[model samples]
Target: MENENLLKQISFIKEIDKIKYIQRRTKLFNSDRNENDAEHSWHLAMMAIVLAEHANEPVDVLKVLKMVLIHDIVEIDAGDTFIYDTAKDHSNTDEELIAAKRIFGMLPKEQAEEFIAIWEEFEEGKTNEAKFARSMDRFEPLLQNTSNKGGTWAELNVDYQRVYDKKKVINEGSTSIWNYSENLLNECVDKGILKK
Candidate 1:
């Protein structure tokens, strides 16, 4: 049974490597290249570690890290959806849930359940860890867009209000981070990088 579990774990590890190929709409900081799911997850994990102190409520940092890292693994199957995508509903939960089961299901049954639960928690965004994980998710793109002089905002012609509304999720986790992000958004509008 232990050997079978080890094999299942290794298979799951190999399967998740496909996340590196799932390209996101967001560009890298000060670069034209698009970011991939794996990079985004890693960045969010780092953000969880670096910004845990700023969370509005105390969060289990490790759980936050897990949430960030596993949050997008479903993208390996459902594909990356742009947060500001108007044509398609942003909450592609049904498709993502299917993908989540298939991808995380590669693990041992117990491990798969844990991952699915964590993923659901992140999706629900009701707990402190989920809120903070979600904040990091929204915050990273804001920094990237700002660094690239309004990376996707300019390229995609995303409106300032839309960006503001979407990024407001940051406030749920960290008031300080949200305050800074709001200021940055205002600056982008003033600079004509984001349309007012």
Candidate 2:
């Protein structure tokens, strides 16, 4: 029964093997292309580690990494909502919330509650851990856009301002990363990889 709880927890550890990134055909951080969700999660976790010290306050890097790794598991059901998709007609939040409930509920009562709390915490960005996790979350997409030559941004025809507007929540937690992200986005605009 003890192990069953762990097993149940893994039920949400979606293979995502068949699921490709929205920019699956695009490059990764170092210009190596064809990244998948697993690769993306791994990369984001690594990014969180590298940038953890830049957080506004002391943060639990391991917790933030866990948050990053699991944050998109709901996408297993709701599918990825391209960050620029502002259609009130298509709210992935409801579907994601439902999926979160179903997926997190699979674990043992205590474990499920614990992980659900962390997941909810990350969603709310109320704690330092959640804030730092979200900081990495917002930064990863920016890195991908700039690194992969503006794949998602180009696909969505999003402007630089639109990117900033979408990611401004990071400012509430890590002003340093937020400022750096803004500067990087500006550099990307100057290079013309992203639109004005």
Candidate 3:
């Protein structure tokens, strides 16, 4: 039974490597190269460790770290959906749930269930850990865009209101980060990078 579990865990580890190939719209900071899901997840994990103190409420940093690391594994199957893309229904989680099951399900039953729960918590964005995990998700891209002179916002011609609406979730996790993000948005506008 132990060997069976180990094989399943190894299978899951191998499967998750696909996430490295899933490209996102946002580019790396100060670089034109697009970030893949694995890179984004790794960056978010580091951010959660570094910025946990900024969370609105006390959070289990390890839980937050796990959430960030596994949050995007579903993208391996569902593909990367650009947050600013209006045509796509961002509220729909059915596809993501399916992907989550298939990807996380590669592990043993208990481990798979735990990962699914963590991923769902992140999606719900209600708990402090989930909120902080989500904040890292939104915040990383914001910094990337700022570094690239409004990277995705400028390329996609996304307006201020749309960007603000999408980014406001950051406030739910960390008020200070949200304030800084707001200032960054306004600065982008003032600098003629993001459209008002």
Steric clashes per prediction: 0, 1, 0
- State which candidate, 1 or 3, has the greater lDDT: 3
Cα error, candidate 3, residue 69 (Å): 0.1
Give the candidates in order of lDDT, highest first. 3, 1, 2
lDDT by residue (tens digit), candidate 1, 35-103? 999999999999899989999999999999999999989888888878877777765469999999999
Candidate 3: tens digits of C-alpha lDDT, residues 1-196? 9999999999989989999999999999999999999999999999999998899999999999999998888888888888977778663369999998888998989999999999999889889998889989999999999999989999999989999999999999999999999999999999999999
Per-residue lDDT of model 2, residues 95-175, tens digit only: 878977777777678866777677788888889998888777777777777877786787668888888887887886689
CA lDDT of each prediction against the hidden true structure: 0.91, 0.74, 0.92
Model 2 worst lDDT window (10 residues) = 17-26
Query: At residue 24, what lDDT does model 2 achieve?
Result: 41
Better of 2 and 3 by TM-score: 3
Structure candidate 1, residue pairs in collision:
none
Pairs of residues at least 3 apart in sequence or in different chains that clash in candidate 3: none
Q: Using alpha carbons, what is the TM-score of model 1? A: 0.97
